[model samples]
Target: MDPLILGALVAVATIAVLFSGVSVATGLLIVSGLFLVLFEGMWALELMPDKFFGKLNSFALLSIPMFIIMGSAISSTRAGADLYEALERWLTRVPGGLVMSNLGACALFSAMSGSSPATCAAIGKMGIPEMRKRGYPEEVAAGSIAAGGTLGILIPPSVTMIVYGIATETSIGRLFLAGVLPGLMLVGLFMVWSVYSTWRNTGLSVMSARSYSLREKLEILPRVIPFLLVIVGVLYAMYGGIATPSETAAVGALLCLLMAIVIYRMWSPKSLWVVLRDSTRESVMILFIIGAAGVFSYMLSSLFITQSIAMWISDLDVNRWVLLGAVNVFLLIAGFFLPPVAVILMAAPILLPIILAADFDPYWFAVILTINMEIGLISPPVGLNLYVISSIAPDIKLKTILKGSMPYVGCMVLAIVILCVFPGIATWLPDLVMGPVR
Candidate 1:
């Protein structure tokens, strides 16, 4: 069989299985396995080496489990509720203040958790009800939570960044550092949009002026300060060369455990057990997907599809900007149908070559690709964030969530454009902090 035909068949089969409601992991694994057997014959079985399993046994990948454990421990301990309570006391005085606070809390939680679903589940539970009780529209409340949840992947210690770094062999520390400025930029954009949207509606009420004495505000900081410390500590260690990215994750995880146990006193053996078990489960799922993706990527490389695509892309008589735009459009369409991880897995292999061939900055392209995937999280038909929000508020129509998410989506597009035009915005911090890329 022509390798290209085989590649197309594998792609179609994966999608067909996904649409048929089979588990994504199972679908990916089965499709890859079948392709190997069918295309490569019996020798394909023999070619499945021990090193394939060994690839998952990386010390760097250890960060995934540690971060997941930390996230679960934090989520299970009701730490998010404390953070929100502390934030609400301070921010609730402004118009749509609670929503702003929700974004703020989500940003903090995203730094800690690094998973969108966990962020959504943690913050949405509290934010949605509070917004509704405060007379905010359901669409606005749900949209804020869903959009805010996306911060998880953009912030440092992000699992997505870690995965990207690992897959591409880019510096994980640099990738983490790269995310900070862009992440904060997105947060600011979301806040501005949230404020503007609430202002335009006029149906929502702002908090009445209730003075909090200096002492009261000071009191809340004690609760909030620890979260900030954890983030700062991790970044400081990484930036100062005190620890590698994996080591920073370990230290951060230990601090998270201590915060939950000693400071909050929410840790029990049972709770700790649950956190470990849940983290293990989630980590296994991620690793499996990654492993299967590795296999598929290997198969694609074996078939020369990546080379073919890169060659074809290079042959096109287009300027760099046009090529970048084409890549964005392709990723956007992929996002509508594929999970972010899958999109990253499939597209990164093909596109990275094209990017390198075109002399594009890898870090800039990574940020651009990440932002595109983030937008996909809110896009129609299959936006993961939309489904997450819908699951929380079943009565709220998907259309409302779609409409509400548009502003944030627009904000994301604007951010992407800024990064494209001013690659320095994404690259400057990384270069300054990481020093000139070798």
Candidate 2:
């Protein structure tokens, strides 16, 4: 059978299963396994274990579980509440100040937590109620939290970046550094949109700017300083050459536990157990997806499906920018249905070759891909962050949350355009600090 025809069939099967509500990991495994055996025969079965295990058996992957644990620990503590209060105190004078504070808290928490739903839950619970008390619009308040939560994957210590780096064999540290500017850029865009939208709408006069006393502002710092220290430590360890990514994760997780127990005094034995249990479940689910994506990636390579697609793209004689734009559009659409990790795991194998063939820097492309995934987290229908915020604020309908998030979605798109036009925004920091990842 023609590989293209086979690839088309595989694509159709994948879409059918995914749309029918099969888990992404199961769908990929079943589809890839069936294709491998059907096309390559029994001998290919001999190589399956090595492919799956090889993907999972990496030093880099160790960081994933640790980071998840750290995130879970933080979520189970008072850190989110503290951070929210601190930001609210500082930013309350700005237009849409409380919403802006939520965005700021999301960005900072994302730097610590590395999970979108976790970030949303952490800040949303605190921010939404606070916004409500302040007479902010429900859509604006919820939308800001949901949209800002997507930053979890774009900021450093992001699990999505780790998965992308592992899948593409890109340097995780370089990827982490690469995300810093783009993440901040998205934060700025979201803040600007929130401020402008609330200010422009007369109904939200309740969002008028107001300042806090200097002493009141200073008093909140102690609440946030412990959390910020963990973020700073992990980053310095990783980017400053003081530790490997895995070591950095280990130390960060330990600090999170200590903060929860010693500093916050929020951890009893039962609470500790709950955090452990939840983290284990989330970590196992993600690692399984990684392993399954490895199988699918290997099958695509062995089947020459990815190579065939790349060759076809190369043969088109189209400009690289056009192809890049098309790929970003496709990813944005796919993001509505798939989470960032699955998208990276599944899409990276197929897209990376074509991207490198066009002479685009892999590092720069990783940042672009990440920003695209970040948008997906708040996208309508299946966006994880939307669901997370909805669950927290059960009275608010999902449609309203989606409606409020649309402007911030525009902000994300604009960020993508900026990155495309000036790849330097993504690359400059990594180059200056890490010196180009060798």
Candidate 3:
């Protein structure tokens, strides 16, 4: 069979299997296995073990579980709840203050968590109910938190970035540094939109049930100082040359554990077991998917499909900007159905060559792709973050959550445009701190 035809068959089969509700790891494994047998025969099976270990044996990827443990440990505490309560106390007097608080909390939590659904679920569980109690619109409350939660993947220490860096052979530290500005930019954009939306419509504002004095407001910091310390400590360790990204994650996890046990006094044997179990489960799921994706990626390279696609696109002689725009649009559409990691793993092999051929900075393109995938987390059909928020606030229908996320989707698109026009927004911090990767 022609390699292109084989590629098309694999793509269609994978999509069909995924739509049939198979897990991504399962679908990719099944599809890749069948194609390998059909095309390459039994001898290729000999390579599977090496491939699995190769994918799992990354020092940098070790951070996924450590960061996950950190996030889970913190989730077990009152950290998220206290952080939001403090924000509410301070911001309730401002327009769309509660919504802003929700976005702020999500960004702060994203800095710690590195997982979209985790951030969405943790913040949404606290923010949505309180927003409802304060007479805030359900759609606004749900939408903003869902959208804000997508920040988890774009920010530094992001699991998605870790995966992308390892897959692309980019410097993981540089990738982490590169994401900082764009992540903060998205946070500002989301918050600005929230405030503007509330201001134009006075109906969105609600009087606080009680007010806080300066002393009380200042005291709120103690409740959240531990989390802030973890974020700062992790970033400083990585950027200040004290630790690798993976080591920073381990240290951060340890800090989060100590904070949960010593400071918050929320850690018990049972709770620690639960956090470890949940972190293990999530880490295993991600690694399994990456292992499966490694098989599919190997098959693509063997078939020369990635190189073929890149050559075909280059031969079209299309303007590079037009090609770039089209790639973004394709990724945006694909995001609605595929999770970000799947999209990155599946698409990067094919797309990155064409991007590099166009003379685009790999690091900048990574940030752009991260932003696009983040939008997908809240998009419908397979919007994981939307489902997470819905599960947390059972009263808010999925459709309402989906509807609410659209405006923030616009904010993401605008951020993409800004990044495109000024690549420095994504590249500057990394360039200043670590120098360029490419």
RMSD of each: 2.1, 1.7, 1.7
lDDT by candidate, in order shown: 0.80, 0.86, 0.85
Model 1 Cα lDDT, one tens digit per residue, 1-438? 665566677778878988898766667767766777776786775554542575586789988888888777787767787777778778878777888889999899877877787777778888888887776776678888888888887788788888887778788888877877888999999988887777677545554545677678778777668867888898899889898777888888888888888767865798778878988998898887778777767767766766766777799999988998899999988888777777786678678878888888887788888888888888877888888888877877889988888888889999999898777877889999878887
Report the number of the highest-lDDT candidate: 2
Q: What order do candidates take by TM-score, descending? A: 2, 3, 1
TM-score of each: 0.94, 0.96, 0.95
Deviating ranges (above 4 Å) for candidate 2: 207-211
Query: In candidate 3, where is summed lDDT lowest over 10 consecutive residues?
Result: 200-209
Q: Residue pairs in steric clash, candidate 1?
A: none
Could you tell me how far off, in angstroms, the CA of residue 243 lies in candidate 1 after the best superposition? 1.5
The 10-residue segment of model 2 with minimum total lDDT is: 201-210
